[model samples]
Target chain A: MKRLKPSLVFIFLVMPCSLLVAFTYYPAIKSLFSSFWNQGTSRRPSKFVGLENYQTLLADDVLAQILWNNALYALVTIPISIGLSIGMALLVNSKIKGTSLMRLSFFLPTMLPMIAVANIWLFFYAPGIGLISQIMQYFGFEPINFLGDASTSLWSMIVVAIWKESGLFMIFYLAALQAVPANLKEAAKIEGASGIQVFFDVVLPLLKPTTIFVAVNALINSFRLIDHVIVMTEGGPNNSSALLLYYIYEVTFAYRDFAYGSALTVFLVALLGLMALFQFKILDKKAHYQ
Target chain B: MKSTINRIAYSTLAISLATVWGFPFIYSLWAAFHEEKYSANFTWNAPLTLENFATVWAAAPFSLYFTNTVILTLIILASNLILCTLVAYAFARYKFPGAGLLFSFIMVQLLITPDILIVENYNTLAKIGLIDTIFGITLPYLTSAFGIFLLRQTFKTVPISLDEAAQVEGANTWRVLWDVYVPLAKPTYLAYALVSISFQWNNFLWPLIVTNSPEVRPITVGLSIFATVESGVEWALVNAATLLSTAPLVILFLIFQRRFVANFMRAGIK
Candidate 1:
């Protein structure tokens, strides 16, 4: 292979690298820099306040609530969605009748925009005359407001996240499941393992890497994806369903508080950086097998 | 007898789960097709009408939103393809100083996406006078780290012999890439394109932050605005609008159902 000239390589790299620097790296560094400052208005010019924003972040009650809400959201949604996806993958991969139809039903939600999904689910969680309410009425029960009530709003968001995400993860699991050596399962069966035992013992362990992959993706998504909260509840009923990103959105865009928003963004970047660390560690391990 | 019973039970479980998974979309369809009165009232004889759809289409600039979304998605997709291809080829074939460090910087973007950097990005766009335009909406996403990564992996897999063989025929670098590398990475391109389209099409927050005009708003942001009116609830009209926004991708998924699944799998496992 011929070595390309340095100038040509520079030309090739300039556009994308410049854009990446302009958008991703520059914004990141700016956020970190601005987090040390305080928000300023025309009446009061901006002031340098080192560690003040972070100090306020430590004391901010709303930030605490938002962090707690996000943690719970991730904790609940990640495990349930992972479990459901594995089940869905196994189901679709099985020799079941109407598997194609089943797969379509499972995966179609993954194709829709999160905003559209939020819209459809908004109706389902509506106080009365909604589907769930109508079903509750049929069963001789009073309708409960899902998104309106603070207690259930976060949980409702969790359900939507699970529904929207599990199908996509199921595709990953399906790919992994298909790649699971057939002879391993056969050998397990030959050792008198039952179907459940074979799955638990042989298949599930092999899925550990996929599980970690999905978990990291889910963690990032739980931080990044707050469209449903914006659409359905708008983090309302006292900010019950507010995740970290939604809070940042509210602080930056809605409230027009840039410094605090920058602080929040820095915090979020740090949190996601941890997840990135975990992923690279796993990727390093996976690379050895290759 | 036990095996038969188990099969029946398993099928029932699978079918029931599918129903639960599909119920929300199915309900939206039902609401879209029915009158407002019949939206929540499931009846065997309820008349289906396109009236809600008509109202929805006339109510908002949905057609314009749809056009903007398509344009935005295509611009980003094309830009990602061309720019990432150039960058990925360099990374895959060339050994430049600081290449490893630069690649790691790109990988940082996979987790801390532009979505999370909204405030600063919005500030930057405002300073550049690109806010509220479709171009502003398309600017940050014109290239993506994942696309670069995927294409680089694909380009690296093309045998060096093929590059040498093409070069021996007096093919230039661009020609070698265009003819030899690009064609061979068709699957990667398709996978990247599909993933990029769906992502940019569905991207809401940044566009919502950047573009406030109907002419520039993508369907997701438009749909959010249309649905969030604090007035009396009109399930039929709202759902009609929802379906309208999602109809294109839904139809595409239906037509290329298997391909969508395969591409998603390929992209995800990467």
Candidate 2:
């Protein structure tokens, strides 16, 4: 009976995971395999064309541009988002009245669905009477084409992304900040550490683990920058803001090229895998206190 | 005197920053409550009206979408809580073979999220004839590595003596789990539940890809149609529609604001 009970529990636990493998991991592997094949139609048999999809992807100028845009988007957004989040966290974590309300306000954007947020932000980016353009005009500057022109489109998307994500990351940093021993800060203060000095010398060092955690989370989210692209740009303005996931989505759905989309997926998965490996390695290190 | 100045400066900076962060939301609420045509105007002087909310509510099957979203989120949450707890218990307590390997495999799912695997996941759904269904949307999220890892960490903190005593009193593993571990891990469960619900509720991409028609489309997806490319450039109406779609969650967050923040903090800590 004892043996039977343990086995039942094991089976119950393992069943869902097995389903995960069959449904998720199986498709993941199949996707990688399918990338090498020309799965042309629903009825016709797919031909095995080894590395052809990859070769095609490499030589394709649009694909290259899309990849570059995605990389640039990640580079610009991740650091800015993390930096703003840290700043927000510091402010909200301070001994100020109405700190809770401030924190809540900051996080409000993140709580809304991305599509909803995008819709509102899109309105703000509108030309004639848009909030941003009106503000620019108020400041005696011409209304800059935020999401319209190719030159400014990707950066505009990055700005919107930073706005949405920084607050969410701030919550993580705030939680980590709360865990910091209050005595440490007090001791630093007694030692005549200036506010900035205390922040850099004491608080920043203590938040290293949090920095890593936030950075990794931001990295993963950076790759998942498809929804905003879909809702706002749709990879428009001459494919300037086309991110990887969005590019893959376009290839699969819009362009109807499943094999190439699968190839992009494989590449994206590989990048994410590398990121996960790096994150795990960093997390494995003993968290430094001093 | 210097400290007082510093405090005031920090407070000013914080409030301004909060305002900048929150202004769009205010704009959204205003737009949602204003006339549909007035949604385009960026003025703060627009008269407030609930007519836009009525239009958004009556335009399509938003109630159905909300019900679907709630149902899908709940199912995913319930399944995650149960399966993750069980798996976490095994990892926490048992000396089973291949346990480490199994746990690591589960962790891999975190790296390869639904957004990344949407294409293959869609194909998988098509193969299993679960396309355009709520089950399709929920299946990929059913076994979350974050939930498993969190519950495992929480379960490990429970005292072993409690489990042993329960076992000695003729209580089975399930009984012990229910009687001791579940009660002890309530906070963790609450934390995980909040995270899970928020994630599933705000989730857009997977649901967008899996479910085809309005019948199975979640609110997020339904909200997307209103913001579609063909829609007229009515910013106010779009923002109004957006606000209406997200109102339930916003209200819930406001009501349980403290608990929600605490839950997020707890989840992050773990």
Candidate 3:
């Protein structure tokens, strides 16, 4: 064991600890405590109205709609992106000509800023002048307002999320696919297994950890990444596309309702905490060394 | 014959999907270069012109935004490198009290990133008189938990023998870390640096909340404000500005495609 020196420890720990405490730990704890109080200003400093903020949270109709929107976003985006990423990995991993070009195209979106991507897609979803609408007009279909309609607004947001996300996740799946043992597939083939059979029975099971990793990370991402929403929809057409984090942003900044915003933040944190719990329990169970 | 047909079908599907994936960016490139009438026109023979770029350049303070982004990104990257290196060295080499607990606290940050605490962080920055300043934007990101974690894992992989050898050769702790650990973790440093640069450069929400003016706004916030507030501006001009904002990174990506992809893959595995 290395000898521990007091000065060395102090020198190293000072900056990291202070910053983490100031930004992450303190604010997180403060938000939890602040959730129990009512909003106040200098004239009448805040009062501890126990559970009142949470009570308001319970009755919040916008919160209900936001949660439903986020849930649908997570459920739909997660699985489809995962499946698409797997397919993308398989395509690139194959010996197809122009695989390098395909790989470049697949990963290009991962490099661009999500805000820029939103701006680019915004043109595509613009009413009659948009690309999709122009094509629809050529085919004689009526031009649909993709982002303006309440019914299709969230789905449009989902399409952008899937497009931006699946590319990055494809890299993860590609790495995992490359690590699958070649001889194992050969052995399976020797046992009369078809390519699809070998993949489902052999290769895919080995990729479970990667899938779980991508899934949990994608779930955390679903809540945090609302840049597109801000740029494209602003959770508009009557809060039809508002997400949990976006709602917290609006409540805290747009409305200046700190108490209620604190409650909403706590709810978001708890949802993330649930994801953490799922990650640990599930990852622990699934991690087995051969 | 059956296998040839299968191969042709799969290749066609792959190429078509790639086109869809690449279409938005390609369209942005097309619109940014051509006239407005051809944004969705798909005219192969349309005369290309730099008029939109000229208009966009005159419209916004994109040059200043570009400079601010460079300054902000460099400062954050430098600070993260220094601070995380020191902290990671300590965690990797020292046997100290509460080290495990402290390390776990840092790990907690990987999930509860500074991004999610935007409201509270804004309040904190405001109370401390950092709001509307570039320093305020830089403060929350100065020491990345992921950076420390990645470097710690990398430093730990540096065989203890090399560390001991460096110390025995009259190297001080700083010298030992610089000469032994840091050199050995060069790839991790490069990977972390690239990831951090892209992330800080592209970061929007927190910076958007903190910065209120053109003097301190990064490229992303500037682009967002430009795109949203200038609703009446033609798509061609907006797309031109968008392309301008993303040009540096995109150019670097095209030039260093292999290294960028490899580093991203390396970062992802951890």
Candidate 4:
């Protein structure tokens, strides 16, 4: 009993806590603090210039465009992917043969690295010698530069994002759809419910929990999975296709400006933190395992 | 008659959607194997060759990249598995003070992941003099919230009776964790490992941000550099490199897909 008491909890907990603190919490708090200061020079350390970074965030035009693009990205990709995932899941979840092969096709994109997928799609969107142009030429139409053009660049990357993420989301929907139980549907049919009616009446309610979970996952991914922007356009054609996180990368790494980057990161952290709080509110009692 | 029609319609829609999803992979295979001239066009008679793989191998130090990836991935996996297991056991079984707050802090990582803190993390790495090292690439990811959450869920499911049986036999805490909890959580381990390994193996932005030299670049980063437009894009060679970087996970998926999907379901993670 003595050996199993709370004294030994320190042994189990210390390492993981140190790691979490060092990596996640420390950087997060540091970024919050540093976002207020200017970057240090050789002789002088950083000095606090309160709200100046936030003011810059408001005044930054390219940053606004990038945030809008991210919002557009979320708007376009989330619902489309969720719809496609539920469809794909239902298709594979049915009592039919050859679903394994179909399941493979859907999830294959989910397997390949995001950067690799970006590379593949880069060829598809490349002008003149690329596949899309070749197809347009076969139809005697002039080729449009997809990624190089400002208007089309964001949408092209959005399409690639849809292709990459929908398949992965399908797996979750498939798991949930499979657990829906056949007898419920059979009972509905016996009660003279049509397929579509049975779907809305019976299936949708059951899928609500799953839909909420998938929505949250999809939302986070919209922010995290912006690697395509790095490979495809580098937020090019004059920052037309930039996203928030990728913009942070550009500011921090490419421009070597950590203070401003920290400000932008605070915005991202706040956005995600709001999302986590929302999930917590809805999931308070349901959250499992202490 | 209507039911039959509905079935056919659904089947057609499903098959076509799958084909649309499959087009890129099919194109990769065809474009990789065929001669460059016909790589863009689909034809039955295009002659195939292994030259692209050779060209790709020659162009980059993928061998070094592969070595770096293996080292970094193994280090992360070993560390995560051990650390997550210990913490998860504590969260599931113990009655420590500040446990709730600590668990919430860890769970907050799901939202504010290491990848999101790249700039500050770079500063952290620079301060510690680990920037550009392989260790730096993995420093922020050594302990994963998803792994801890997953293992904790798995451990809570473990019958308390088995643990007590081991305890009554005079097994110490670590021994009970090893002899009782760890063995029972094999499926969860495999699921978390697969996710961690595959994700870290293919992770680009962090490694790209942290590692400057080719010495510590992983295959995904290597692929990005190898396929840069400055080199005058050759479809065959680029596709070959993509396929090479992607093949291990693809092959593993093909073989253990059942285990993969099963573990995800059993572990209660999507």
Q: Estimate each model's TM-score.
A: 0.97, 0.95, 0.97, 0.96
| Per-residue lDDT over B200-249 for candidate 3, one digit per residue giving the tens place of the 0 to 100 score | 88899898889988899999999998887763558998899988998898
Model 4 spans with C-alpha error above 4 angstroms: A1-7, A43-45, A282-290, B229-231
Question: What is the DockQ for all candidates, taken in turn?
Answer: 0.71, 0.58, 0.65, 0.66
**lDDT of each candidate versus the true structure:** 0.88, 0.81, 0.87, 0.87
Error of 2 at A221 (Å): 0.7
Error of 4 at A261 (Å): 0.8
Worst 10 residues of 1 chain A by lDDT: A281-290
Candidate 4 chain A: worst 10 consecutive residues by lDDT? Answer: A1-10
TM-score of the second chain in candidate 3: 0.95
Fnat for each predicted structure, in order: 0.78, 0.64, 0.67, 0.69
Q: Which candidate has the top score in DockQ?
A: 1
Instruction: For candidate 1, write residues B1-270 as lDDT tens digits.
Output: 987888898999999999999999899999999999988889978998999888888888888999999999998999999999998898899877888898888878888888899989999999999999999999888879998888888788899999999989999989999999999988888878878888888999999999867788888887888887721458898899988888888787678677766765664464
Q: What is candidate 4's lDDT per residue for A1-290, written digit by digit as tens?
A: 12336576666788677988998999999999999998777898889999999999999999989989999989999899989999999899886668999999999998999988998988888798888898999899999999999999999988998898888888887877778889999999999999999999999788777777778888998888778899989999999988899999999888878999999999999999888888888764443334
Which residue segments of model 2 deviate by more than 4 Å?
Answer: A1-6, A42-44, A286-290, B36-45, B229-233, B267-270
Residue range A1-290, candidate 3, lDDT tens digits: 47678777667998667988898888888899889888898899899999998888889888899899999999999999999999999999998999889988988887889999999999999898899999999999999999999999999999999988898899888888988989999999999998889989999999998888789779989999888889998999899988999999899989998888888888888888888887787684663211
Cα deviation of B174, candidate 4, in Å? 1.7
For residues A1-290, write the lDDT of model 2, one tens digit per residue: 12324666545566768767865688789889999998678788789999999998788899889878978988888888888899999988777888888888888888888888888888788886777887888899999778889998998888888888998889878878888888998999999999899889998888888777777777888888578888888888999988888888888977788898899888888889887777667674743211
